[model samples]
Target: MDLQSIKDPSFLKKMNNEELEALSADVRKFLVEKLSITGGHIGPNLGVVELTIALHKEFNSPKDKILWDVGHQSYVHKILTGRAGEFDTLKKFKGLCGFPKMAESEHDVWETGHSSTSLSGAMGMAAARDLKKENNYVLPVIGDGALTGGMALEALNHIGSAKTDMIVILNDNEMSIAPNVGALHTVLGRLRTAGKYNWVKDELEYLLKRIPAVGGKVAATAERIKDSLKYLLVSGIFFEELGFTYLGPVDGHNYEELFENFRYAKKTKGPVLLHVITKKGKGYTPAETDKIGTWHGTGPYKVETGAFVKTPASAPAWSSLVSETVRRLAREDERIVAITPAMPVGSKLEGFASEFPERMYDVGIAEQHAATFAAGMATQNMKPFLAIYSTFLQRAYDQVVHDICRQNLNVFIGIDRAGLVGADGETHQGVFDIAFMRHIPNMVLMMPKDENEGQHMVNTALKYDDGPIAMRFPRGNGWGVPMDEDLKQIPIGTWDVLKEGTDAVILTFGTTIPMALEAAEILQKQGYSIKVVNARFIKPLDEKMLHELFSAKLPVLTIEEAVLQGGFGSYVLEFAHDHGYQNIIDRMGIPDHFIEHGSVERLLEEIGMTTEDTVAKLKSITPKKQKRA
Candidate 1:
């Protein structure tokens, strides 16, 4: 099949089964070639090729609803849905998105990037269909890894009780980013090994029906026995008990088998779960064996050698600093334990995991559970350091407030990537932790100005043991600063005046500190003496120094790589208002609207967070001397 000729899913549907298989092979080859240069989600997209093909072939997409969980695996779906030509521009600024965007196509029912949301979205679509008296299938292709989430479980319980006519495709790749962890994964493992019992039950029903009058009652009795047999035969009894008719342990890679299973599910009345087994990196050897999930989503690489291109590993990332600091501290303090919600690699806790295996816990993408679990561990005299991304921590805000802060539990939250994470765009930006966490009672929210400060804060949080403490750091490398072997604890809730000037002051935190300092240097050359203060602690706000800004009667600028509303800048304004100062306050940070994809440098410039933008704004506020006429 020629690549140019097979432009859309409708083309593949017109082809016979054998021709379709050829087309899939061609498509996989195209993906491997294009992805090697473009750098996108290769492994997940590779794994879902056959499933996507079968789904598009089986259902009329625009008319029938199909929602993908997490949306990382939607690359294959995107290709079939007529977005294949855009693969060259994947994840680039103003190009194709990495995840499903509703504006991209009518076929894409939901815009998703986070995990465990598809089930609930599917239920809404299903309910809408029932309301309109429309006969259309609502299918949500949810990965087995996502089923561990509390929301997914809740949706499952509701779907079971309501008995909605919906088809759920459980794409079991036996992994999610990392080797899946927890009891839910264990249950699925047992079920996968046991295979589907649908055939055996059907055979028993056929044999009993042949027995005549007694057979009618016997079939009814078999139904009850089958309900009982579920617990005996499989561990997926939890899903079945919820009222869903269990369908398959079908081969997701097998196009014919997947199509048949999908057909069977479509014919069924109540909720049906079609469990299809697949490999994470299907058809690609390197991805198939990738255990760390590095190949899951990445930059341009060599497909032949599976060698990622040597994009100079910039300065040591802040995540690495957190990981190293935690590992060093854990070695000294036996009470310290590390926890993350399925992001050990991304959080840079691989070393900590190796050093303190028992003390380390990967809570399997359950942020709410991880926060509560950390609180529970803290209560038992164990200091649990939860390493979570700020964006994901939003999912567990209530737990952070209720279980940790309100109860005054000693849980150290290592908030990694606590600012604008470029390229992955809005859904992934970690820019709200400061605002959300600041107001919580007993919560100490602090972001470091440098890697050394980050390390010091980690030590401070561990030592304090007062209540819930959070330390946020940016996504990438710290500004080139020397490291010291000896650990020092900076006094908590204190701000550092890096440079003193008379004209005005620049107050900032985390990633924006370097930008603030650079802008100060540029302004200093223009004869405008500017002060730079590293406002490390966002919650406490360094009351004395903050009050001094008003006391000095200087014009002020607050910079942060976060939204302005209810953020660091807002806090500065509130402080000024309370102090009754009329000093001009200028806010320079991310705007209220969602930012788009680009390189970090490009994004900073685009959003006017760079030194040039700050200098321009500062010049606007700087008063020109009155004419000497």
Candidate 2:
């Protein structure tokens, strides 16, 4: 049968083991070729081909609810569910999303982009099933790295205590982006090597059966001995104690082993955990050889040579500049330390980690703990730089407010990817940081227009000892601006005027600054001179400049690459209302609705945040008298 003709996985139930293996091969080939042009989470998807096929054959999806944690590995699942024809538009604007979208198909029972959510989601489904008197199995496939998250641990406790009828597939690939860490990883490591436990259990059972004509006392003693031996030899004792029936150390790639364990798990009454071991990037050679996770997710690459298609930007990436600046300061400041929630490579902290291994902490997928951990360090007068992506930082809002902001600590937060992150889509876009962070008391938030200002902001954040300070930087390469030889501190509550004019004032910062400047130049040619100011400090607005602009009665336009509500522009409007300025004010930013997956340019255009959109907005608001002149 043709691979694309597969509408559902029901056909897999009729296929033999040999035929299943052939299908797995075809799927792997399809993934490699498709992803070669449109890049994605190739390594993860490639690794799970056989395991995904096995699961489909054994269980009915949509009805059974096979929830994939983090959803990046669901490419194979999408293929089996008749979405293979949509591969060309994967992660594109208005096209197929990278992660599992409930709107995409019925088989995608739950949507996920953030880690460690599947277990909790599965527990909810299990409880709902019982309440409705339904008997369909509730299964969640969670990775080993995601298992280290506190939420996953909490869910494990609850599900075990409830003794729910569900299946938790512990997909052990020994990675979540990078290599797994923490004590949970250690426990899993022990379980992986304890394959001899089954042999020991069988041998002990045979010995117990050999006690011929044993009476009640002898039989009881034998039973007690057998139980003790089982605990001593088996590595699943931890899970067993947690009220779950533990199964496997099964080979995820082998159909027979996977099907057998999955079938057994389906029959188990209480919660059952099936430990399956599979290799990430199982089929492709380059991805298979990856040790540090270069192939986890990537852009276009050559299939034969395994070489990435390079665009070769002239400037450094925003993450590298910020991390390197922190590394330089750490050389002089002994109290300086860095923390990341399992993103050493993505956060560009490898240099810092290499120089100060003891000072760097990768907290495994625990964002909430990482935030408070930084707060705890601040309590001791240590300067902790928490480097985290904006989207992931949402998970630590409570810690940020209750622990950091309330206590007024000096934790320097480096908010990486703080704007429209392309390709990864709406789930990963860093657009909400401004609106979320601005409301928190004692939290000083700002962004930079270029690498030079970015480095200065880094220095400013680390040096500031008053309260919690954060500097947001957009994803991708910095604007190749000239840098200062020596670092300097930027004053709090200050704004810099990039261009001077009298017709109107444009307040904007970060990625949108270039657009503002372009618009100003266009307006300049048409005799409508405009002023462009970098409103970098988001929380503590530049009261002095704002007052001057209002007093002069210059029509003002505030723009940002973030959501409109409670954002920088909204704050400006609030300030105008409170101060009784009666100034002509207009705001431009992302709308109330969620932005979808697309290129940064495409998303900006969709939201009317482009250079052309900026010019059109300025033209609409310009005075009739000024236009005639």
- For all predicted structures, in order, the TM-scores are 0.96, 0.96
Q: Provide the clashing-pair count of each candidate structure.
A: 0, 0
Q: Kindly list the per-residue Cα lDDT of model 2 for residues 203-272, writing each as its tens digit.
A: 5767767778756666667757766876776765778778777777888899888887887777668999
Best-fitting candidate, scored by lDDT: 2
In model 1, where do residues sit more than 4 Å from their true spots? 1-7, 214-220, 228-236, 625-629
Q: Please identify model 2 stretches exceeding 4 Å from their true place.
A: 196-227, 626-629
Candidate 2 residue 62 Cα shift, in angstroms, is 1.1
Local accuracy by lDDT, each model: 0.85, 0.91
lDDT of candidate 2 at residue 190, scale 0 to 100: 87
lDDT of 2 at 547: 94
